[model samples]
Target: METCSLPRRKLAAPLLALLTTLSLPTPASSAEIHSYTLPQQAYSGSRERHYKVYVPSAMTTPAPMVMALHGCKQTNDDVLNDWGMKAAADRYGFILVAPFITSYDGLRNENCWGFWFEQHIHQGAGEVEDLHQIAQQVDAAYSIDPNRRFITGLSSGGAMSMAAAVAHNDYWAAAAPASGLPYSEDSSSVSLSGQCPGSATFHAVSQVVSDLTGEVDNGYPIPLLLLQNKNDCTVLQTAANNMRDAHLQVFGSGDFKTAATTKASDTSCSPYNQNNYSCHRIAYTQDGTTATRSLVETIFYDGPLTTPNAQDTDHGHYWVGGAEGNNGKWALQIGPSYPDIIWDFFSRHSRNGSQPQGHPVIVLQGDNPLTAELNSAFSDPGATANDLEDGSLNVSADCSAVNTQAAGSYSCLYSATDSDNNSTTATRVVNVVDSNSPVASCQKISASPYAHIGAGRAYVGGVSSLRAYANGDNVDIGGSFDTWSSVALYEGETGKWYSQLPAACSGTGGGFVCQNWNTTNLNHVTAGRAYYGYYTVGGNQYLGSLPGVNSWVKETASGYFQAGQCSN
Candidate 1:
């Protein structure tokens, strides 16, 4: 237990008198508080401790037990009276056990439980062993349920309670550590020296718990409920976040999902981060094959300190109820009732958990491919679905968005539903692209009978010329080939064209052919400047170029001028 050491100040006379009047006990309540002394051999050395149990007079059947621990410099009587545990027990029909820590003059400066010490906290020895024995003793004396045992504490007691729950997890079903630090190897040192950040301390605590409890594929072995104050300066909010993260890491291995989130009403509490005093309520469930249950829950409250010093500043160290000191300045003003929330959560869970319903699984076929050619057909590959409880599910697909006639990417969804109404879905992508190329041919014509004319032929200007034709299987002959075909003569070595047909060729019977040569400005043939004829249609859909043919040379043949003279 750590105490906030602040300068003492004198209180006003009237307020001091009022606090004195409130400190006195009223009449005896319906619940009877019983005191019990532990066996001398139960604890180590002469430093012995006692425990108090709260049992309602109306108790007839076996009831659940909650082991509550107090902070440093606090007694079991203070915890019972100030925290209203007796009243809670009467209302909730449960038993309450509060233990008092004996002061050690030289060993400890404060009357705090030795929760930080290694020997006192571990299994089979120290405080944990003593607490276990006391539980057994209480069970024998009163009707107690073994599966419904729980533990909680504040400050150092809260820290110790966490350690006890971990060491004796087999006995305790759940634990709630409110405004408390985690039990770590460095805890004893930190408590004796000073305090560290909550996250740094809890990281070490997580490692220690992992070492003690062998790592399992499933989530945390025991359910946990964490409570913290947003404005707490002593314990700090980081500690609660770290503790929550640690428990989630231990228990959130499989398909763990957040089930619900509840925000407190603004009228009941102040807003922190736009959330009310009972800031937020988050619940998580781990749906494992063997055991499915709600594993963890957390509540963050926005309020003044549980105990405020003389300066009206809150240290936020105590449990939900205000303690004996500070004149009720640290009492909760707005938020959900703490005792009611705690009992509701605890009562709903037990040691034997329930099985969870599994979700459906959907498997989709690989990506589909299609061509963009006109009138191309498309067929879906389909999908598959399965479930653990619901056998093979009927999978339905929707490919209405797919248009095979257009050239673009498209998507469709495959979905399935189980008997339990659990649904699963998958997406398939359809890629459509153009896969057709245009077919074309060119022929050279010679005016001179001496020139050889064929597909690969060339003749001098004014003596012969060339013509080309093209057609596309997937393209509109009149709109594409007829409107975009052309022919040109270019330098074979340089690839620089000398001239091109001004406009597209006209449409013939089944294809498109180049226009009349006389209607175009064809470059004059020149000697020693090698050139070739080229035909292009539909933006490179089809292209024709000269194939290793030499330009014709001027010559005289049969007493007539000829342009078909070749060296070979």
Candidate 2:
């Protein structure tokens, strides 16, 4: 991540030139906007407050709610008209709430939310309390889905949205703070005057949410989708980065993991840690056992407003341009459609509980064999199963078609089912071949880069040993062909062999010994069972067999490693 330093030179000249040529559009007549005044007592330390609600015609019972807060000098109507959020509400079938902040003497900008004030930012106080009360009022009046409620804001409003999310994580399922600051206690003063204060230190998301929700150990994490403009001058890009890191810390506990990110011509979708969180704590569940999942997504757009005839290099601080008065200001020039992206992220999550399926894990006892000796008795090695929520599971193996008397490749099927009936399958392969002497082929007699085994190895105290091996005539003697050599193990019981272990060999000789070769853990190996070993070199494989000394083997030894039983 390269730091974006504000270009000190030629910054104001280009901005002034761009603003001079800009033309504001006339307000469009909108019938969806409805005005409502909150009771004076609803918000203390503030005068009469008015809020507007936009209920889309397509809204049905129990629809999601989106609270949009406007920036300084921007009105609810400006945000509704300019931000182009109403179309999203109509498309997504969610109720839109836009509130207005009347003039105040100490305000740096006209009609700005008091995001800097401690009372407004604090939980259950001033504007924060007012917003909560208004949400409750809206819930009482309309069929708003309490589990699917959301909030977003631009600039100061963006900062306020962060405050709201942090102070009241219980109310909002997710928050999208567009070009806003993460709420911090150190900054005593906040303004929309284009001069941001120094960056403030913040707590981890887990700690903050736990403190706010009073569930120190098991609090539900509020999902966040932070939107930023690389060229945002009003709210520095650093502020956006700080906010993102802060939220990721909250959701990821300082180890934020990115799940997937897609970059299109005009839009980029970077969803973080997908399918990971089972939001059981905040989920609204009817069965008391099921829960839904949540995710955190972040998006950063490049320079210039997407609107036509807009400046290509300027601070994108305004809502997206389709509003009558926008005049192509404060929009991204080459990035995802902001409104659509926001609605898409908001629609994917809900506190309404939905059961999540947990997949079971299957562990095979033996490795897939590259080759098996003919006329050998085959037995099922079996497997173990475990599930996240269902605990231990019953695993079954079927090797009915294995014919060790003939030389051919075969597969054994293994399946497992959990208590919830969720099942998974694993396959092990076996190869039987005629007794053929392994050819002694050594391209270069150099020390194997990997670990190797010793002949007739002994395990003291009845402990099992796991080993790795690799051999190939073309195996790089210079230690560069680390990926070329491999080993496989054949389970006598299942007649199945597992071949996933890579060879890490060391020792300079035609028969270089390898260690760390076992595919399955030594603990999982069956006691008193003989497991056959096979090594591959340059596409040619050598099977271990007793009384079959060839150029590849100077001594005809046991073709298998016998596991010793340990007394308890």
Candidate 3:
């Protein structure tokens, strides 16, 4: 979100020309920021929405992608050029997309995204659908990874980023809403000149889940990073804190404490404070839990504006810590580059929690039906497999047990093996029922980028982790050890269940549970379970309303690697 200095649409002639020059994408022969217009298939208010994507030179075909939504009065060009996002693409080898509002004629000519518009925030509606369509289009054209997709925005765009994440939880692995107000149901958050009260934007923990009833109930569990600035008069720090707590409740996090504080001045990141903001990484571990888990983090800044060639420092609403020499309006060159910060968080996650590298990913071609009628014709829906080392592997299906002759349960195992001889399997349990009607799959979709924060973490020992997701309908949901009663890891393939860590679980609500260990001084966790809405509670198993993917991630390194997100 650029153009925070002075009034919107009132920029002088020379500045406008400079902005025009800066916003243009560099020559395609080098790196590129190509623009396109996507037709609006869902929304009636607008005919089409415009967006631009930046594909770095020599990027991998299935590289991750992030959608950067700009603030009102800002164009996609500002994001790619002014904010150093394009340059970051060169370094990170990831695609960057900036979405522009159909119209920018805002109140005071500061028009931006429709943060207050219900159509934009809710799914199956207007703008949110448009965004999803845009993402699907990108995937079709570029073959971007469905699991590693991300979304972010500034100011009003920030509000949309977080809000849209709620409505379309299945699409994004993670979301970073930077330098924006906590989103509830309010229009005041978009006011650049006035401070929006936190009460209007922040929701209580109890209300957070309730307020997001229809959506959260049927979507993937996604982690968030809320970026804020303390020195800004437009949006207050209280809003950021309220938002942090709000999301913790959404994630069902026990308690988050400030674990580390790093100033750009303390490292080589910002020796001269070129990026002048400080990041406070928060950890969810408290009460004797291992220290590696983090559900949500607040990358905040409270400092004098010393950006290289920034338009002004009066408003803290701009990108706080960005690449040096922003030299444009609405972005401060204070703090380390945010692209690295956001990318770090984005890299560790995908649509199904953590993606195990080199493993063959098997996708079921037919819907995993939960129920079938008695004495009926049953066909096994087959699957396909793709691996990192082996381009495409064959998936063998065994559905011989799926007999519609009697009313009971049947199972099919989809198996795939990569070139490295590492094998993986997906279990599809189809319930042969007493009724005549065909089994129906839930209309809503969901994904768990990480089944829980610790689902795919590479730690030395059994890691303390949390798996909290929307439990609209938990037929046989059991993993939620509402309390840290026992540490357990069950391998369905091996039919082996063992005690692994202490656990706390709360359910019939969100299937929320915590698996904790006393220390992080152990080896990489060998405990993980693949979920496809199938769970067993008290020996009775059930399928959830929102079925998800069954994928595995195997990583053996701690996730302290440095990375991008133009967060705050």
Highest TM-score scorer = 3
Tell me the deviation in Å of residue 561 in model 1: 99
The top-ranked prediction according to lDDT is 3
* Runs in model 2 lying further than 4 Å from the true structure: 1-31, 42-46, 103-105, 185-218, 253-295, 305-314, 321-335, 353-568
Give each model's whole-structure lDDT: 0.50, 0.50, 0.53
**Lowest lDDT block of 10, candidate 2:** 272-281
Tens digits of per-residue lDDT for model 1, 1-568:
1111111124444222212111212113355776665544433532455778777655534677888888776778767765656656765567888887754323553666676576776766677767776676666555677777888877677777777877787788788877666555344332232322222233564574464455222233677777777766666666666555566556555434223221112122211111135456555556522222356666777654422212223355456642111122233313334454465456656565421234455544332332234447777766666554565679989988888778788888888898899787767677776655321222112222122111222222231323221111111111111223333221111111122211221122222222221111012111111121222112221112322223232221111112333222
Compared with the true structure, model 3 gives a TM-score of 0.52
lDDT tens per residue, model 3, 1-568:
2221111133445323212222322234466556666654534434377788777775765777899887766777677766767766665567887877775322433646666665566776566666776676566556577778899887777877877788788677888888665544466544345432322344454564455654564545576776676665556676667666665555542333232221111112221123234545443422324332245656765644322232343445676435332645567554545665665556545666544345565655433444667887887756767664565689999989888887787799989998789788977778987653322211111222133113421111222433332222212212332333322232111121112211221121222121222211101111211111232211222323222222222211121111111111
Model 2, 1-568: lDDT tens digits are: 1111111223345222211122212112332555665554433554455778877765665777999888776778767766767776765567898887754435455666777676676665677666766666566556667778889988778888887877787788778888777675223333235432323344454444444444212355676777765656566566665554444444543232222121112222421111111111122121222323344555665533222322322334555432212333343212344565576557556654421234565655544443567887787656666554565678888887778888788988888887778778977787877656332221122222332222111111211323233322212222222334433221111111112211221132223222223223211111211211223222223334321222222111122222221111
What's the candidate order when arranged by decreasing TM-score? 3, 1, 2
Q: Model 1, residue 240: displacement in angstroms?
A: 2.0
lDDT of 3: 0.53
TM-score of each: 0.48, 0.46, 0.52
